[model samples]
Target chain A: MRKIGFSVIYFVLVSVIFILNYTFEHTAMVSYSFWNITRAVLLIFAVIVFPLLNRRIYSIAVTVLKEELRKKTLYVIFIFVALLVSLIHVFGKIAPANQHVFVGEMGLSGITLFGLLFGVFMSSTAMYKEMEKKTVYVLLSYPVSRQEIVMGKFIGNMISILLFSFLLSLIFVVSLLVRFGPINSVIVYSCFALMLEFVVIVAIATTTSTMLSSTSNIVFVIIIFLLGHMTEKITHIASRLEAQRLKEAAEVFVRVLPDFKRFEFKDALSLGTVIEPSVIIASLSYALFYSAVALIIGMLIFRRREVDRL
Target chain B: MDHVIEIKGLRKVYRDFWYRPKVIAIDRLDMEVKKGEIFGFLGPNGSGKTTALKLMLGLIFPTSGKIRILGKVPTDVRIKEQIGYMPEESYLYGFLNADETLDFYGKLNGIPRARRKERIEKVLDIVGLKHARKRRLSDYSKGMSRRISLAQVLLKDPDLVLLDEPTIGLDPVVSREVKDVILGLKSEGKTVVLSSHLLSEVQTVCDKIAILCEGKLIKEGNVDELLTVNGETEIVASGLKQEDISRIKDVISSSGGKFISSGHPKETLEGLFIKSIKEKQESKSN
Candidate 1:
């Protein structure tokens, strides 16, 4: 962690000097402080995506995903994420919304999308590919527990996402500092919260994939992500219908489903308001709770899996 | 002698998706494979040979009964250090080259780098894959992939080796090479439990044999003992004429010998192929 933190700080310092030099050469009219502010804003956006970009796993579950995604077949996904980030930069010319977007938000959103795509690939292929290809047998024959394999895979995946977000976040921050004002810290925290939401979604998707087909798992997770934000509204609608049983069931479902809206730090980003520490802690705790449950369920299903058939 | 594997009333029933027919993958199957002997497990397709292997490896849990491998429970992590397994299919990470793949498995087995390099070289040579060292597994043919899997088993140098159809799709030449590798493993004082449908291959390699069908152990014993246990005899007599051959069955029956099958003097296809190749080499030497 110290090494990672140092690298991030070093990258920011280097970007600040380079961006300042470029700003003076191109726009001699702009003041030094203005250039400094622009670099700071950009760095803030970069921070959003930074967590995903680093090449290491913070935990064990993410470590397995990191290893799996390291396979050359999955390199294309990383390229696609980089491409999307560059395209988002291009879009800044057309819409002012692009300018208001935090580098972190853009990056976290891009990584979330990439992570989901990778999650689909991970969840669908995790057991099925191993079983079909007979790799599961070799893996199972090892002294490692089945739960460890599942945990390792999940960790590897999460870590790959982190690596992507981290590196891409740095790239994004450097780009931002070159163009806009300095990045604010509030946006950084919000983006981190958003990425955690993505992790929660991935965990659920992974659990679903252990039992369902690839196509079905993707569809199911997407629906969960979509409807997850509307839990409060869904509950309200159930109450308006005046059907007590339906309302009760809807309330129950809403609690069971992740309230992704809570992790959407977009409101705080747009308003430029600092999020309360309690809010951040609460959201993080919720994500952890969901992720832990989903992982446990996935392991249970995987333990019963026969390697002979996918 | 210590038994490397012990089984009692082992059963596995799949209940999910399909109707609950209680398909017995291993039905009260009881057997023991002693240490330091090559035990051949033979059964036709869908006869639960593979299932029994899976259960023993703890890849899947048995619905009932228990299995012990290397004096520990099959799934016990401690026993994993003592057992190596080569599955029927060439299931490997296609992205990694042979060297990287071996390194990864070696790491999983807790082998250090210096010793791992020495062991990797030895096993790669054993599997005859020293030349194609840098090629990614995706580029490998089915035979090469199988050889790499075999190399992984050898790298561990475990006390017990379980091979499922070790030479299923290999050409005659490669198959013989693989057979020799298995034979070499036995000479190292390692116990091997292998499953194959090839009766002749089992006959040549195994000291003890177990025949399974429909998830049940039908027969098992020393190869020679089982053959003679039912008083069935096979004779290879070369000097008999046509009329003498006809009378030979009666002579044997009258002499209290039970004839299993009678045939002309002809070697097995595998035997003839091996013999002809050897003869050509001997003739060249002369």
Candidate 2:
């Protein structure tokens, strides 16, 4: 049932993107067509890379999956997302004739919000829980590398977050179809961008958890998320600054933190604006690059960390 | 003469958040655990026994020094395939049932599915937890959880088993059973490194023992050699009358030897506890 559901959603998403790309191309919207093509390419690339995961990484990931399943954390989060999505009608009723757009915005926002909560909460606690419980001793005693543990955890938590996001997005899609009547393909692009943002959040949280306590890690991740979203504005302010040193400091901050605004498509989706394919590819590449760097830093810290601290 | 574990000048100094040296857990420790022997690591609380165990298992790094397990670096992943470790506490995933816990560790060791299935059952039976294998570890008593911990350590049939206070909270009966399992592993030519504060238990099972105090080895030798009294002797005999006792005393006096006090031998509390349980079982069978 899950596979079929996922397949149908996937097929519908692809078909919609392609159909929109053809329509936009005929109307001379080259940028929109290119964006769709990039989306299709990224989808294909993800499908290809997922199945070739390492065996050790797969085992750790499976353990994390089992832990989450047994703890029912995923179930609770799914129920919350579902309940929030279902409650969107209350907001829809208060809106004007374009109530469908309001509903879509609320539904997507709920998915992103709940998905971030789950992602940040789970990732920040992943390593700390293992240490506090002393389970890392047993795990490290096995024939697995510390890098594998960090990577596996990042992969596992990512999977859980993605699964929940997928479910919530499905509900949102259904809600859109029922109320909005053949939802725009831009919504699909927004969801993809939201997922990419989650990938960055998970990586940062996972990396921070290796060195900090869970609470501190969560705080740090949230601060980074906030700072990341303000990168462009911060950089603009730096460019306008009269003090050279302050301008340079702000510019450095901009360079250091991720530009989360790059992954924001909600405004475009709502305004029915076209996104360029090059922009989509560049945003995805940036996310993947940042995630890899974060994961690498996390693995290094994890490898050097002493389990005796807990 | 083969050493399964070797450590030399090992030091572990823990640091605070500011990177200031806070505690010196192990200080220039040197030790070697030979193959196929049950080596006991005896120390008081906070005496660095657990720290040393963690260092040996590569769960923690040393500040300065070297450690090798199974002739490989402690952190070498390949060495873990033949090593089993049970922490001072159970440290198990509370969400996983006993069966799942064992299965999880088995997978980490990269054991094949067929062998893991067979060995999981075997280890569970060895630890007398076969009946409760379906129960979540969180629901288990302290003793039961320790047994499951032991079961996971033995799941891979590891050649070198490092058990840190394996019988800490167990009942006398269960402690005896755990010691027996340790001995059983020795009988299979597997090297067992056991750390505990229970001196009697260590004396009973360990062929050689090392006592650490304040992160330093105060003593290390054969159990009997370290425990033996140079000038004293104990003699036990049955059905001896008072006259026989006097004659023995006379002989010792004539030889300029002092006779120590003598009394009927008494079983230890642990021994008596185990014996009574065995007798109860025997009577029920009869």
Interface RMSD of each: 5.8, 5.0
Per-residue C-alpha lDDT of model 1 across residues B199-220, encoded as one tens digit per residue: 8789888999999998888998
Where does the lowest 10-residue lDDT sum fall in candidate 2 chain A?
A1-10
Put down candidate 1 lDDT per residue, A210-289, tens digits, no spaces: 67766776788878887997887887787786777887888888888889888777767777777776666656555655
Residue pairs whose backbone atoms clash in candidate 2: A35-A277
TM match of model 1 to true structure: 0.78
Off by over 4 Å in 2: A1-52, A276-282, B282-286
Q: How accurate is candidate 2 locally (lDDT)?
A: 0.82
- What TM-score, computed on C-alpha atoms, does each candidate reach? 0.78, 0.90
Q: In order, what lDDT does every prediction score? A: 0.73, 0.82
Given candidate 1, what's the lDDT at residue A271?
75
Candidate 2 scores a chain A TM-score of 0.81
